[model samples]
Target: MNRRHLLTITAAALAAPRLCFAQDAWPSRPVTLLVPFAAGGSNDVVARFMAPVLEQKFGQSFIIDNRPGGGGSLGMGMVVRARPDAQTLLVSSASNHVFHPLVSGDVGYDVREVLVGVSMLTDVPTVLAANPGIGVNTVPELIAKIRATRGGFAFGSSGAGTSNHLAGELFRMRMDLDMTHVPYRGGGPALTDLVAGTIPIAFMNLPTVAPAAEDGRLKIIGVCTGERVSVRPNLPTVMEQGVPDFAVRSWTGLFAPRGTPQAIVDRLGTAVREALAAPPLVARLTALAAEPIVMTPAQTDAFVRQEYERWGPVVRSANISANG
Candidate 1:
């Protein structure tokens, strides 16, 4: 009575995993790429740009979900809790995933531990700008003014633990200044404050602040790249402005929840390489002035690690906190 039943149950148990794997079929359903910022933002733009191509490649709907809040912590937390299936991914940037976690005391997830990097999308160099009323024209003059004030000035960032925050903190440490960091919800708000005299200075992505600088609302003190950006050759870099070896570039990348199948990660990485290589996508990125970057999963992981190491000390030393 029991022998046949036992054999059947055992066979079924042995076949269960394969059945589940078959069911997975990688995006048997629509895939969601969570953009942890407002729509039309850089991360969102990248996600939207790639969505259709990914859908075409996989023959499934590729949806973009914009969950912007907590300076990117909110959407990140959602991704952290999502199933390890390949369907849910985070289209993220350094602001929240890398720098935010360093400064934020309790973000509920470590980016490196809970998410696996798929590929880096783009790289944007930082720019240090100031309100025209600050009366500073160069990095040296800015430093001198801060010193004269006994480090009394204040600067603003897109938000706590964002690239802007870390860049500002790095500049403060490198220059031995004592300016306070004011965190806003996004770069737009920070730039608004800078132009309105609510804050005297900011370190922001070049694209976000360049227009204001050109219009004379804000003055470009220096770029944070190792060399002058080709598009802005007239603007000197911080390295040439007496701060040696100081460079910061913000980037966006694709990541899946930890425990996702390596095969899925590799597949996604290949798709990313294909997307970036497309001439139309490349032209769009070029038009937006974003430098497209490609990285394998291993390379992306190592790059994220390097970023954490680079910014961790600055965040800790500055005591940057999302709550504070």
Candidate 2:
């Protein structure tokens, strides 16, 4: 070969590895963290809280994009279609994975098929509480009160097809109660109505109503988890209150579009695991009544599959639709 051609070939060979390295070095640009809910909601709160920690770890900006619509399907759909480059992620709760698909007509993507779970951030227990004026101190008492009122009872939920709403539906079916389901725009409004006695009872996230329940403005009849949360060990579980097979847990996690590079997934997952363990982050989540979770990517995937299997039948049997 001519000297000029040989020199050019040598330069090209040397630059190839640098280009490959740049391509493989994930997060070459700012990461877009999608929260599939309105701002100021639980999902948004968790995403905004974790963004700074993750940005610090990766040395890249983690911009939170709130895409709220269709009961969290809009933003989640965006993640599903995003390139599997680890730059786009969905920070959402169990509702998006388990309930939204089950109820919404077409969520545009199947989480099981399109997304890979990285790790769960927290599990927020659902609480069944009533206005103090309702005078029910336990699940059984609440059941009895409902019976005495002859189907006059009404319960509020954050919105239709939400974790809180399904929890209330499960309670109603398990106990065979005849009560009206009142859907509110959000949990805060529902809780306000409950505290004002406008709504007799509500199945809500513990964080939203814990203050009122603690101060005796709202009477917490039972926790809707299989086991009582550590933060409220004194409270009895609904299962223990004579209701069989009643459990509902609200959780948030990080997920990337399916087929993301394993190396990227591993690196991001480790950062998340580290962030969850940070003392300041842990303390902040604790103050919000959120329990941090630890799980490998495989484990996170399995957990979501199990939840889908468990809750799918409940939603199907109830014939729950997003419209109602």
Candidate 3:
């Protein structure tokens, strides 16, 4: 080959890396994080608090685009179809991403195609609470009663394909009982109905149930985790209550469209971890009624994939769907 041609190829190869590095040093413009749920909710608050910190660190505005509809699917679909640019991202929850996939298969994006970035959030446990007037102070007792009755009892969830719904299903399957499933359109409605005695037992998320548990309006039977949470240490876990296999927790994480440069992924992952580790940041998240956790890009990908596989079959077997 001629010297001129060889030099040209060498320069091209070197320039390719520089181009990639340029992409890696992203957030040159404003970064948009799409929160699928509406504003003023739990997820919204977390996003609102973290946006300023991220903007300060990266020197780029982090804006939240609220697109609430279809049980958090509308916004997710928009982001999934967007360019695989590091600028467009999503803050998604387990139930919306995992359970929704099971119930609504037509969602525009495939779990395998979306790139999980980093997890900056986790929802506290929804205690296995029951009204004492129902004669069940613990999960086992509730299970025993439902079993003895041959699944005559009814339990409510936030909505179809929601985390609250899956929690009850997981418990029923674990205890080897046949409990009827009743779902409401949203958590607020479900909780109201539960307190009014329309549904004797239900599994709502932590902050929502905590007030009732403390006021003697509800009896917490167990937590749906591997270990008891420090927030409510006295309560036992489902595993601790003898259903060794029962475990479920609603969580959220940041994600980018697929094919984003790896360097951006690494940088964003580190930023999320550092943000969560900051004491003041953690304090703000706690005050917002959520937990801020950071997982590396690879770790987030593995966790999301595992959950999708695990719940895909569970939802199919239980015949849980978004359709009423």
Clash pairs, candidate 2, are none
The segments of candidate 1 whose C-alpha lies over 4 angstroms from its true place after superposition are 1-29, 59-61, 132-136, 144-151, 195-197, 210-218, 317-324
lDDT of 1 by residue, 155-239 (tens): 8877777887778877887887877888776676777788999998988877677667778899989988888876678889987
What is the TM-score of candidate 2?
0.83
Off by over 4 Å in 3: 1-30, 38-42, 68-71, 103-108, 130-137, 140-154, 173-200, 211-219, 238-244, 284-292, 316-319, 322-324
Q: How accurate is candidate 2 locally (lDDT)?
A: 0.83
- Model 2 error, position 73 (Å): 1.7
- Candidate number achieving the greatest TM-score relative to the actual structure: 2
The backbone clash count of each candidate, in order, is 0, 0, 0
State residue 28's C-alpha deviation in candidate 2, in Å.
4.9
Off by over 4 Å in 2: 1-30, 196-198, 215-217
- Number of clashing pairs, model 2? 0
lDDT of each: 0.83, 0.83, 0.74
Local error of candidate 3 at residue 95 (angstroms): 1.3
Over the full model, what C-alpha lDDT does candidate 1 score relative to the true structure?
Answer: 0.83
Cα lDDT tens digits, model 3, 1-324, are 999999999999999998887876788899998987656434555677778988988999999987766666777788888887778888877766777777877676676566555554656565566767788877678877787775377888665666777788777776767777786644556667677888888876665566566778777788887787766677788788788677777777888888877778788878888888999988766643466666788878888888878777777876665753
